[model samples]
Target: GIQVEQSPPDLILQEGANSTLRCNFSDSVNNLQWFHQNPWGQLINLFYIPSGTKQNGRLSATTVATERYSLLYISSSQTTDSGVYFCAVGRSSNTGKLIFGQGTTLQVKP
Candidate 1:
């Protein structure tokens, strides 16, 4: 079994600010993903970085398997970015069952 934890617990920022969220896992995982749970409770996949770096617009993520950790970066934050960010990992590469972290709640004020 694998366990995940997210840091900062909570965050607050103004528009245009930048922030970094962290995720630490207890064991080796074959798959990892970053997700944003919107106010409506919809989980939006942000990244699928299992052992590398990836960027999409104002968001980016990096995972280090050796360190058993991952990071999510948000640049020029906006109110629209406010949500609960989650880090999920799967023990088996092909398994869709994932264990999620406690999540980091971000609040961006306009």
Candidate 2:
């Protein structure tokens, strides 16, 4: 079993501003996932980083498996970026049981 926690439970930002969100896990994991829950309540997968760094346009993520933590970086964030970011981890892909972090809520104003 693993525990997950996200920091800065809430965030407010002006359009174009940058932010960094953090996620920590209690134990080692075989895979980690980052998701963005949009305003419409759609959970969109952002990254699946078991370790190392990954990027998707203005967003990037890095996972340090040894430290049991991960970070999501948002650059030049837009209003569309406003959403709840989640971190999930699981022992293995086969288990399909992921532990989710509380989530970081981001609000970007125009």
Candidate 3:
């Protein structure tokens, strides 16, 4: 079994600000993904950084496999970036299931 946990649990930011979120896993994993759930409950896949660093636009992510943790960075934040960020990990045994973290809720204001 695998377990996922996210840090801060909540965040608040102003437009053009920056923030960082974290995720920690309890067991070895085959893969990992970051997601953002909007107000309408639409889940958007943010990253698939299993053991590396990646960036897109104002967002970036890093995963340290040996440390069993992952980080998400948001630069120049906007109101559109306000949502619940989740980290999901896939077990090595191929259960075809992703254990998700509690999520870090972000609120961005003007």
2-89: candidate 2 lDDT, tens digit per residue: 8899999999999999999999999999989999999999999999998999999999999999999999999999999999999999
What TM-score quantifies how close candidate 1 is to the native fold? 0.97
Q: Please give the range of 10 consecutive residues that has the lowest summed lDDT in model 2.
A: 93-102
What is candidate 1's lDDT per residue for 1-110, written digit by digit as tens?
Answer: 78899999999999999999999999999899999999999999998888999999999999999999999999999999999999999988885899999999999999
Error of 3 at 58 (Å): 0.5
The Cα local distance difference test for each model comes to 0.95, 0.95, 0.93
RMSD of each: 0.7, 0.9, 1.5
List the candidates ranked by TM-score, beginning with the highest.
Answer: 1, 2, 3
Cα lDDT, model 2, residue 92: 94
Error of 1 at 106 (Å): 0.3
The parts of candidate 3 lying over 4 Å away from their true place are 92-95
